[model samples]
Target: MPLDTGQVDTGQVDIGQVDIGPLDTGPADLDLEEGNGVLNRDPLQSHASIGEALRAVRQDRGLTLDELAERTRVRRSYLEALEAMRLDALPSRPFTIGYIRAYALALGLDPEAAVERFKADEPVLDEPLRAPIGVPDERDPRVAAFIAGAVVIVVAIVLWNVAQRAMNASAPPPPKASEAQAWKLLAETRSGPVTLGPPLPAPVESTIPPLYETPGLAEAGPDGKGNDSAPANINDLSDAPLLDLTTLPATFTPKGKVYDSGNPQLGSLVTLQALNNAALIIRGTSGSVYFARQLAAGEAYKVPQLPGLTIDVSEPSDFQVFVAGQSKGVLPARQVLASKLAG
Candidate 1:
């Protein structure tokens, strides 16, 4: 301390402006002042750029990220990114530098030294961010598969919905059992002209009272209880089996021939066998006898042995008599009048 003799005391020296031993300016004291100045320097401190620092002095201490985190309370990820030099992964430039300062302090180094060193070499970046690293191009396989799967699922759902709507929209009201025959005909007509047998214009699923036999048969009730009774009207008599096509006079009219076999191998002449139940007896010109017996509705008939004189089966109403491959006329059951067999 600087002292004047007039103001000096022996035990405690006093001075008007005495030097307290040159203001306590030892190395330790000077270091303390310098450290305090660094701590309070500036609010907006500068930071280094990415990859600017080739090496870190604090890292030489051999402290691990976990070890340093224990000391500074910074997260392990931040400490790792800092040491890894993965600057882009960090929060911000100022924050990264600040973290580095704390890390240096935790490592028993001067915190300001780390900051100053980083500030000296600013990192330089030349490009803006676009695609991420390790990602594929526009036609990547994984991306395409994902998109395709999504599209397929969407289409399947749409098709299912369409099918459900169609089924619901086309639903018809239920009908009485008595009207089933008429309704069935109408329904079949929607598909196309239904042929019971080829050459027969209409398929006869319903019992067809023959054109001539219609005048000879009786009109039974809806249940057909009186089908055997005598003719109730002129039309009823036409249903009786009064004539075979062979017994008819040549003056009567007939139409149609087998235009095509539909199958060339079978040709136009198709023969069906009479089962235990048959319709009529067919005797060929070659002395072959075939029994055509109780004919069922929609049932077919064929001469088993007559390969060339086969019967082209159709609805009874569709039966046209083709003699020697020429059509005489269509056979309306019970009305057997032979006209020209050539159509």
Candidate 2:
């Protein structure tokens, strides 16, 4: 071989150094171990059930159900149900499908394919449609009876009201009040003087004395006349004056210009007469408008003597106030509170 080195082509070969270009620095191809080395089976091979396929992949990856549960964050019991294909033991279909997807991902298998296989194995049950039951048009006898009773009660109430009205209509009117009673009522309503009846005669003083003061009975008078201050007959009241009805002053001078009329029904008729053209507004204390108008000369408006009523006059002097037929001269003020005039 040493003698042939000189005869061989030196240009094509190197004696001590050879150029093989840069060595391949990329990662070398690695032959991954398919299954548990002993069986050398494909973990992702097609199986009759998704559960079997998942179980095989799990075993190939050397993972127990407890480990797979930890990896997938699924319950061990649920994983067991999935591996055993116990659809009843698993959760709802959607939840079971989620578990399957998680299990496939943990075992390095396709999640969608696993889900498809799970669906094919356990088809979802369709609920049978039910026909609606018909309701009868006939009403309950108890309800009808209740309605009839209600109607009867309403009719009875109406009839009772009619009968009460009829009874009231047939009843006689109340008796009229006597003159004395009328006077008493007027006195109660008005602050004015009321003449009840004519004045009675004065009482007569007896000139006789009591029988106990007789000279023979007990003590004697200076003239020896027995109690001349006492009446001769105790029962003789003929000399006594008649009992006077309750008396009142002959006249009532009101603090204000207005005075109450003796008649209660008519009240105090307050007449507002326009001496000249004037604008006036008659209202209540609560601001309810009773009258608002421009009066012509000599026009008159009878103001109701209702309490709390008031009058506003544009020209106080133009309007003349008359209460209970007595003239009060003119409007007391531009805005007159009628209650101030009430006696």
Candidate 3:
């Protein structure tokens, strides 16, 4: 039913027809345009970065990082890392993703959307390749056997060294040999005596008359008398001719200041005596060095009667050679080659 009211003049009132009908209950009209609708809001577009969005949402919810950590069961440091976008400060990718999801859930946000935003904001890193860790199989008997063998070998080596040291420590040292014994030993080890050439010719006798047999010397006396049985004047003997040393026997006398290699001999005992301190080397033709040392003054070395042996002296003038105890005099040169001394 409709009720019609007649016009009534009032300052701010006007009468009108009123119709009573069913009550209208419906949704209020809303502007559903591109940027004006609540359902069409872009969550990521509200902040400059994912970290800023997370911080803004947490701040809007009146929640501190400590409260968020308690709600999400994460450390406050990790929550601060997320809000600060310090991905390196957080854990690994998967663990960080879990932390982000938990944080978003505590802030009443979409966990998956937050994780996606976190992933988008995260920079790609070229992580180094790591070798996969292998778990050893303890059931293999060969491995245990190898380990035992290595241990046994190490222990055996240690014990062997210790035993060697102990034996060396307890063992008596060898007795020292005298110088004469050492020479005897050296002589015994050398080669046998060499065969020498034929013996040298006997010395020629001088035809000159003897000094005592001189005619005037035999008859003259101390009284200047021609007596047959008196001592002669000592001055009268000076008139006799001097004996020629060149005519002496080759056996007992020295050859000269130079050795005659023409007739090399391995005498009964050929010795080398140092007139002064000097170095000496006695080497054989076979390249065998029998003696090499500094010979003190007056020190002697018995030559090994070996054929084809040569002598070397640091100073030829400081050495003397002897054959059968008679000095033959100094060497001809510093080096007496095999042809010089052993021919």
Best by lDDT: 2
User: CA shift at 90, candidate 3, in angstroms?
Assistant: 1.1
| Models sorted by lDDT, best on top | 2, 3, 1
Identify the runs in model 1 with alpha carbons over 4 angstroms from their true place: 1-65, 72-95, 105-113, 124-131, 138-276, 279-343
Question: Tens-digit lDDT track for model 1 on 204-315?
Answer: 6889785675542356633366555443332232443334556433332322111232333532232222222324444444645444345543333322322323222233
Give per-residue CA lDDT, model 2, range 210-242, as digits (tens).
Answer: 656434744553334656565333222233223
The global C-alpha lDDT for each of the candidates, from Candidate 1 onward, is: 0.48, 0.68, 0.66
For residue 153, what is the lDDT in candidate 2? 100
Candidate 1, poorest ten consecutive residues by summed lDDT? 38-47
Q: What TM-score goes with each of the models?
A: 0.24, 0.27, 0.28
> Candidate 3 residues 147-265, lDDT tens each?
99999999999999999999999999989999999999898979688789999999869878756655675456645586545543322322223444344333333322222222355
**Runs off by more than 4 Å, candidate 3:** 1-40, 129-343
